[model samples]
Target: MAYFSKHYHNPGTEPGTLVAKSDLGRPVTIHLIDYTEDHLEEVRLANAADCREYLERESKTWIQVNGQADPETLRNLGDLFDLHDLALEDVLNTGQRPKLELYDDQLFIIAAMPFYNGDKLDIVQISLFIGKNYLICLCPLDEDPFEPVRKRMRLANNRRFVTRDIDYLLYALLDLVTDSGFPVLEQFGYQLEEMETDLLENPNQRTLARIHGLKRELLVLRRVLWPQRELLTGLMRTEDPLIHANTQVYFRDCHDHSVQIIELLESFREMATSMLDIYLSSISQRTNETMRVLTIIATIFIPLTFVAGVYGMNFQNPDSPWAMPELGWYFGYPMAWGVMIAIAAGLLWFFKRRGWM
Candidate 1:
C-alpha cells in the first residue's frame, strides 16, 4: 500500500546537470554487444575508452550502462557520442514521464518498465540514445527488462538479429517494455476476481482497504501508461532518420499494446469503484435485517406486558362488588389463566396467518 515518489532536487541547481539519485553507491558498469551479418562480439568494457574502437566499427553497437554514471563519466560519454547535455541529465535523473526527444543526430527516448515485487509494483526508468550505428540504454542495476532481447541477439542463426538495423533493436526493446504490463495486469485481474468473490460471500473492513489500495495502484499504472501510448504515437509519426520507416511500423504495434494496457487499467478502476458501492450496500442490508428482527420481537411482547399489568392491579378490599366475587371463586382464577393463554395463542396464529413470523 506504500508508494515511492520521485526524489527532490536541491534548489538552484543548473539545468542539464547530471545528478545520481538511487544508484550512487553502485559503480557504473558498461557492457558492449557488437554484431553484424557475419560476426558478433560481446564484452564488458573496462572504461569509456574501450567503447571507442567498437563505436568506430561498421557493426551495430549496443552500449548498456548498468548504473547511474557519475557526472565525469557522463560528460566523457556525451563528448564521445556527441549526445546532448540535457538528455544525459534526464538519464541520470530518475522518475521521468515517458517521452521522446530528437537531438541533432540522435533520438532521445524515455520509457518506464514496471515489474511486480511480491504484490508491489516497482517501476524502473529506461533512457535510450538512438543513433545511426550505435544505441545506448541506461538502466538501474537491480533488473533488466531487455534480457530477452539480448538472448535473441545471441542466437547464432537468428537472421532477424544479424540483418536488421539498429532501429529494429530499439523497437524490440520498446516492444518488450510495452508488453511487460500484461503480466502485471493479469495479476491485478486475478486479485480483483478474488476480491469480488470475497465481497459477495463475506465482506469486511479488510476487503474495503484492499479495494482502495488496488484503485491507487491502478491510478499509478494509468499515469505510466497513457503517456507511453502517446510517446509511441509520437515515435511512429516522427521524421527522425534514426527510426526507420519499417521500424515505425513496429512502433504502431507497440502503440497497440499500450492501448490494451490502458484499457485494462480503466476497467480495473471502474471495478474498484463498483466494489466500494457493493461493500456499502452489504453493510446496510445487514443493519436492516437486524433491525427487522428486533422490531418483530418488541411488537409480540407489547400486548403480553399489558395483560400482566391489568392482572397485577389491586383493589381496596376483596369483598367489594367489583373484585370480591371473582377473587373468592376458585374457578375464576382458572378461567383467567385460560383466557390469557387463549389470547396469546390467538395472537400467534394471527401473526402466522399474516406471514409476519
Candidate 2:
C-alpha cells in the first residue's frame, strides 16, 4: 500500500555508474536452459565461466539470474556478455520504469510484473538482455512470472519452441509479463463492484478509506503500464536486426495487452471517484431527514408554549366588573385545557393531511 520510486545515486556520482543498493545476502543462482531442435538441457551454473560452452553452442540459451548478485559477480557477467556498464547498473537499481533500449548487439528490456497478494498489488521488475542466440534475464526474486513459459518449453512435444531464435523467447517473456496484469485488474474489478454496492446501501468511514486506497493503487498501476505500452510500441517499430519481423507481431500483441490494462485502470479510477461522491451524498440525505424531523417537533411545541405563557400571567382586582372574569369561573381551567387540547389536535390533523408528520 505504500508508493515506491526508483533509487538514485548521490548528487555528484558519475552517470552510468553501477551502484549496489540491494542488501540481498543470499548468493546468486544462475540457471541455464540450453535447447536445440533435438536436444534440451537445464543446468545450475557454478559461476559465469560455466556458461562459456553454452554461449558458444549453436542452440538457443536462456541464462536466468535469480537474485541481484554481488558487485563482482555482476561485473564478471557484464564482461562475459559484453553488456554495457550502464545497462548493468540499471539491472542493479530497482524500481525502474518499463523501457526498452537497443544496444549494438543486444536488446535491453525492463518490464514490471504486477500481481495481487492478499489485498495489495506487488510489482517485480524483470530485466532482459536479448542477443542473437542467448537471452539473459535478471530477476529480483526466485519466483517469477515466467514459470508458465518455462513449463511450456519443457512440455513441448516437438521442436516448435526450441527451434525459434532468441527474439521469440524475448516475446514470450514480454507476453507473459504483460498478461500477468489481467488477474490483478480482475481482482480490482470485483472489489470495486462490491464497494459500489456498499456505497449505495450503507457507506461509512472505512468504505471511503478503501476507495481511496484502491484509487492510489490504480494510479500506481497506471504509472507502470503507460510506459510499458510505449515500450512495446517502440519494440515493434524498431528496425533492429535482433528483433525479427515475426517477433514484432508478438510485440504488437503485447502492446494491445498493455492498452487493455491501462483502460481498466482508468475505468476503476472513475468508479472510485463516483463512490466517493455517493458516500458524501448519502450523508447529506441522512442529515436532511434528521433536520426535517426536528423541525416538526419544534413547530408543534410553539403554540403550546404560547398558550401556557398566556395562562401563567397574574391578574389584580378579579372582582371588578371589567376584570378578567374567566379567572374567577370554575370552568376556566377546564376551558383552557380544552382549548390547548383542540389546538394540539388541529395541528396534528393538519400535519397528517400534509404528509409531514
Candidate 3:
C-alpha cells in the first residue's frame, strides 16, 4: 500500500499546511525543459527557482519535481511558482486519488503511473500543474519515467508538445502515463490466462493466494486509474480557453485513451473473477475425488467386517440350549476360514461387476 498521509487536508483547504507521514520518499532531482517552436534548451537544476524567468516567458516551460521527501523544497517551489495551496497539499499526500482540479490560471491534475517495482506492479504518484506558459510535474521518488516524453518533446516534428500551449504538455504527460498501463495490463491478462491451466490441474493454497493477490492489485489499479478517466473527461469538456481550440482535438484523443484504459480494466476484472471461479471449482473437484475414494474403501470393507463380527461371537456348545455345536468339530476353525475366503471372493467379484473400484 502507498503510505497514506493521515493528516492530509481536504481538497479545498489551505495549501501550504504540512501533512505528516513518516514514509515520505526521498527528494527528486529537477529537470528543466525550456522550449519553443524556434528554440530549445534542456538542463538540470540545483534550485527549482532557476526557471522563474522561463515560467514568466511566452514559450512553454516544464519543471518536473521528481520526489516529495523534502516538503520544504516543495513548499518553496509552490511559493515561488504561486501554486494553489491545495495543489501543494496534494503533492505531499500520496493517498489523494487521481483527480483534476482547475485553479485560477492553472489546471492541477494528479495521476498514478504504473510499473513493476520488481515482480509486482507498483504505482508512482504523478502531479501535474498546467499553468499559463509552464507545466510543472512531480512523481514519486525514483528516476523519472517520462524521459521518453521528454525526448519526444525535443523532436522538431512533435508540434503537439512544442508549439501548443502547456495544456498540450499536460495532455502529452497524461497520455504517456496512461499509455504505459496497457503493457502492464496485457502482461497481467496473459498471466491470468496461464492461471486457468494451473487452476484446473492442482488448485492449492499458494494458487489461491496468488489469485487473491492479483485481484487486489487490479482493485488498486482501478482505484488509481478510474478517476483518471473522469479527469480526462473533464479536460475534454473543459471550456477554459487556456486549452486552445487546436489543443482540444488532442484532448479529445486523450479522452479516447481514458476509455481504452477503462475498457481494459473492466476486461481484466472479468478475467480475475473467472479465475476465482476456476480456482474454487478445481478445489471442489479434488475434494470430490478424495471422497469418492474413501467411500469405495468403506464399501469394500463393510461386508468383510460384518462376516468377522458374526463368527467372532462366542456361542455356547450344542449340548446346551441355544448353543452352536459346530465349534466343537475338529475342522471347525478351517471351515470358518474357508467360508470367510469364499465370502471375500464373492464380494470382490460383486464390486468389480458394479465398477466400485
- The estimated TM-scores of all candidates read 0.89, 0.91, 0.87
Candidate 2 C-alpha lDDT tens digits along 12-85: 88866876775776778888899998878989998877888877788899998887656676787788889888
lDDT of 3 by residue, 1-357 (tens): 443422465677664676656655665688988888888898888777676666567777888888663667677677777888767777777667888887778788888788776677888778887878888888876688888888887777877666667777788888888888888888787878767777877778887888888888888888888888888788888888677777778878877877887798888888888889988887787899899778877776677788677667878575687776666779988887777678767767887899865
TM-score, prediction 1:
0.89
Instruction: Write down the TM-score for model 2.
Output: 0.91
Off by over 4 Å in 3: 2-15, 19-25, 314-357
Model 2 residue runs over 4 Å out of place are 314-357
Clashes of each: 0, 0, 1
The global C-alpha lDDT for each of the candidates, from Candidate 1 onward, is 0.84, 0.84, 0.78
Native-to-model Cα distance after best TM-score fit, residue 26 in candidate 1, in Å: 2.9
Positional deviation of residue 285's Cα in model 1 after best superposition, in angstroms:
1.2
For candidate 1, list the clashing residue pairs, or say none.
none
Pick out the ten consecutive residues of candidate 1 with the lowest summed lDDT: 1-10
**Worst ten-residue run, lDDT, model 2?**
314-323
TM-score, cand. 3: 0.87
Q: In terms of TM-score, which candidate is strongest?
A: 2
CA displacement after TM-score superposition, residue 4 of candidate 1 (Å): 5.5
